[model samples]
Target: MSKWNPEQDGTLYRMMQEVVASAGGSVRGVLWYQGCSDCNPDEAPTYMSRFRAMVDRWREDCGSERLPFLTVQLNRYTAPNPTPEADACWGAVREQQRRAAREIPHVAVVPALDCPLSDEIHNSPAGNLLIGERLARAALSEVYGRPVHCRAPEIAAARLTSPDPAAAEPTIEPTIELTFDYVAGYLLHTGSLERVFTAEDDAGLIPVKQCEIVGPRTIKLTLTRAVRGESRLHGAYERNPVAHLPLDSDTYMPLLGFYGFPISGAQYDENR
Candidate 1:
């Protein structure tokens, strides 16, 4: 019954067409929530491309070029012992889902990192309700043109703002300032923020000493040491990270999880 897979005889697609025909030969939007099976090393990397292709095919079949597609970002799976590669694949799929929302037109993604799991990979009743509400909000705003606040907070930019360019070494402390978009009011967190944000240089993971909300949409992360080569910043970037994710103070929408965002002023080489 998984919608991600099309039957060999095109049963699922035919079913969709039949449903549309029953509904006066027109459809509103699509709410997609299945991606667990695709969360593997072989499928994660090409998720976005495959997703885009599917969306394109669906829209064409449905006779709409700009159909709204509301996607729920994959929630955490915590039952079976997951390997390092498995964890990475989960993160990769989530990031690709987020990217799909950003790069594809009329596509939107809702955060489910905070949703409770019914089992290893399924959402609990309450979690499903929350996801349903989020999808409805997205459909209203994106498809029906309702004035609703449906977008999740996303990382807009990350800048290396500290180690004060003028200050000498050894005594200097390094910091990276992250700016977020779609934040309703300010950002607030629950547990220790230290475990939520991380950085990676050519040498590997950089220890984050502290994280503080210095501005309405800004989070400043102080690193244990200065980064020399190409680096990237990650927030809640694991399969099930021990995180203190920030939420919008007003709407309480959780910030979208992200990975591998290039940190500006971190000696990043774009060519590489």
Candidate 2:
């Protein structure tokens, strides 16, 4: 079964059809966890569109328009010393997976970044157990209409806050307040918060001076310098980011990694 091509005649789709025919004509839902192979320069950019098309075809073949799909976000891939381009590809695919979950109907994505990797790219047995529990929770809640908290926390908004609103001059140090959604309770981080959050402008990556949980669902990030132009906030976006990541205090569900969340209130600097 090729990961890049869903149009092949004798592949996973055909095999799935055979299985469904042998058993029953219908299935409860589809659990998809295959995206590592698509993490490449050639495939990563088009991953979301292709995936959406594949889902449409699956629903058509399965005779259900609103068929539920539970997908797993790409986990850590720590082989040898990977190149920068490879890391970018992996992160692109992950961000695309997140987009699919938000854009598509009846589709949900579960985080696997906290899960342990058995090999270079595959999840460990113990990690698989955790993923299985997460998948079951999503299926029960989304498909069976059961009351279960399955959705992982996601970045809602990132806005600039004045360090001192009453100051006469514009403050050089800008504070960004990041708000999250789907959090069951307060947000908590396990390791250094600096490694988990970053900001980027036209120049490059900006150093985060300080990070603190200012509120139940909010995190305040202090930037070293003022934003030059349009800036973006990234969290847990590296190929193999920190193992101890930010998670929900109540459900312990890890927050999903995001790529280019626009930081509002950035000063437009033409001469950067």
Using lDDT, give the best candidate's number. 2
Residue-level lDDT of model 2, residues 1-272, one tens digit each, is 15323564437677677888999787879999988887788988888888898888788877899999999998988887878678778777888888899999999999999898788888999999999999999999889899998988899899987556578885578889999999988899887787788888988888899899888899989888877877998888777876777789988889898877889874644333
Q: Which stretches in model 1 have alpha-carbon errors above 4 Å?
A: 1-11, 22-24, 165-173, 266-272
- Report the CA-based lDDT of candidate 2 relative to the real structure: 0.84
Identify the leading candidate in terms of TM-score: 2
Report the alpha-carbon TM-score of model 1 versus the true structure: 0.89
Measured over all alpha carbons after superposition, the RMSD of each candidate to the real structure, in angstroms, is 3.5, 2.4
Task: In candidate 2, list every pair of residues with a backbone clash.
Answer: none
lDDT of 1 by residue, 1-272 (tens): 12543422456777778877987998778888867788777878878878888888788877899988899988888866768687667778888888999999999999999988888778999999999999998988888889999988999999986454455553345789999999978998887788788888887888799999888899999887767688888887677866468989887888888888889974533233
Worst 10 residues of 1 by lDDT: 1-10
Candidate 1's clash total is 0
